[model samples]
Target: MADTFHDTDALVAALSDADLDRPPALVANAHITGVSVARALSAHDVPVIALDRTDSGVAPPSDAVDYAGQVTYPLDDADGFRADVERIAGALAFEPVAFACMDEWVRGFAETEPAGVRLPFSDLAGVERVLDKANLYALCEELGVPYPETYEVGETDADEIVERLAFPFVVKPAHKRKFEEAFGTNVIEVEDRGEFEDVVAEAEEYGATVLAQERVNVAVGADTSLASYVPPESADRDPLAVVGNAAVRYPEFGSSCLVERVEEPAVREHALTVLEETGYHGISESEFVYDADREEYVLLDVNTRPWKWISMPVAAGANLPMAAYADAVAEEEYEAEAATDGPRDGRWVYLPDYVRRCLTDEAFWDVLSEDDWRSLFSGEFEREGELTTGLYRPSDPAPAVRYLTGEFTDREYYCSC
Candidate 1:
């Protein structure tokens, strides 16, 4: 990794000076997923420029990153973010493919449609249409996909909302990126009518549209995500897809700390249907939560980026970042090979979090299955390859060491799922 550039101008100058044969891929948000993106593309012999807004995360020390820089504006600032993208792109001789690793970056990139950069996903309008959860839920309903029963706080009356949904409902933003920026958390669970009303007031104050959604019990079942990619030209073709489930997610309602690749054909089928229906063209993860009561999987948010456990698919022999890159740069439209889940499914564990949980949570082992323990002990998961786990790689050990000893020790460790 190069010395971090504090501003876009210096970063662009450095990028121009290094003028290589091929255009470098730009990875936004140099966190865990960004590091994985750099590794995936660099392994394919593509040059990479990794960018981030904050210096707190693990990507700064990763060997996989060729160029590391800091952007002045936060991802929510569309104008500032767009200006920075243009600055970086204008300096490079060849057109760079821009990859947004987090939701806010996805929103910024999708909305801006930077002049000189090539986006891995669809055009601005198509990308924006799918990113908003409100539109996603409506599309799910049109396609007969199962999602949690939800009422928009702004559109529906407060009394009607409480009457329609059960107690212990969730209050969340229809547009997640903005809400996360405002509140620093994704979803707020409200236990009673007073709490729900208070949350609605809070959301209104921040100019965010909150939704009252029926709470699905994740304690009984797993959180599943259909990580997939659909080519730009061939929307009709079946997506490169893999199903992964969170065996353990800390905070109960928060992000998955440990995910295992599993065979969920139903998840694949549903995700494919959603992708095809939307005419979505790019890498995406369709998240689902198992509703034990309904004995069905309920559709949640659809992330239009490289997700946290993206390396799991790459390690399982389906490299989405490579596929997206090839499609963007190739003369002809790139067709991805058939997606494989490997002989044994892969595991993606955030080692620091997993280790911390073992020390702190006594019931952690009780939740995981015998097969999960066996696979971990036998090293079957590690056999798939280097990018399978987050932060730790024998080939590139510094990031893990820094993360474990520095960020995690200070309790400042944060990864946007």
Candidate 2:
């Protein structure tokens, strides 16, 4: 095993020099998430090798060190998918650390690859448990964690669903990806039997099985997650370390649009317990819904890959990407103390939210007083730099330029069902 690289400065210097012979290969999926990872690695001077399916002829950043050829696929074919993985994996040497950007891509890679590849994190079963809504809820039950009251309703047993479950429940597809097209919504909160049947009929169009879960009357807000990496051997053990985390603030009462950090101990304890019970390894984020009414936390779901708010915790202090890289390449075990308590005053507002606040309302003014406005706008706010920001600095701005120009508009690569 190679000696672990501990010094962030040395790692950055070696990566940027362009003279160093060995550079870590980053497998990017051409999604914004993947591009974010690629940019972060690049900022650290690490070489990135991006791969994507070219349905629209879109390419990754031109400044990328080495851009591999595209892997195309039909919308329906399943068998041909393995060929794509084999092609991607074949290009790399032994034990190349892979960063999966999309859920299906990660599933495909895990299912098709040999054990020689150091995936090291979540296995096939763990990924399925985390991604499948029904399975995730079941895991929560087994762990004795609080969750939304849920029951699976197959097509044949649709009539019995209402009889078994209460009214005003949410009907979601068993699969997360099919939520938008099949149900026409990520979740449908039905008030009565009539609405439930209507939703089931709509779901039939996408050929999806549904799960009806009782909507916890708690205030609808985004969930908080703890990001951590569990080793292959410690898959059944407690988390090796918590890298970082983010909390999404929901828009209205549905999905999370705004995200921030929360250092609550109760949220962390429940998240760790859920992860350990599921035997999850790799980079996983366990989510918890804080019920302000009950003054307690409920386990929501776990994400097996870097989520949309992956950069949030990076702004906080625990860098999951760097930890993942270190775990993948290093010989020694890496452990860092879990951050349970800290000053919770700082806020990292998302760019979209900030824009919305500026254009739509006086919300910005209320949040930032006259004195606070100068420091916040001046870039003096302590920002936990993103992984991509660390990799792609101002000295070499080509990657940043290409990234911002929409050269990598191939969204399909990272959003597979």
Best by TM-score: 1
Model 1, 363-413: lDDT tens digits are 666444566556555655454432267767766776777676765366564
Question: How high is the lDDT of residue 158 in model 1?
Answer: 88
Which stretches in model 2 have alpha-carbon errors above 4 Å?
1-20, 43-45, 54-59, 62-69, 73-81, 93-95, 114-117, 154-167, 177-181, 202-207, 220-222, 234-258, 330-347, 361-417
What are the per-model C-alpha RMSD values against the true structure?
3.2, 7.4
**Reference-based TM-score, model 1:** 0.89
RMSD of 1: 3.2
lDDT of 2 by residue, 1-417 (tens): 011221323323333433333335545455445655554455455556555554221225434334443443323343555554444444444345677766656765666654334564676777776778777778778877778767887733756777767677788777766667664456788999888888877777777778887666564444566766665553234443332333323233423334556566766777677766676667777776666656666766677876655545554545466556656666645443234563223234444343455565543333434544444445434332212222233444443444444445643223421
Q: How close is every model to the real structure, measured as TM-score? A: 0.89, 0.73
In terms of lDDT, the poorest run of 10 residues in model 1 is: 334-343
Tell how far residue 164 is off in model 2, in angstroms: 6.7
**Alpha-carbon lDDT, every model:** 0.76, 0.54
Task: Single out the weakest 10-residue window by summed lDDT for candidate 2.
Answer: 1-10
Q: Give the local distance difference test score of model 1.
A: 0.76
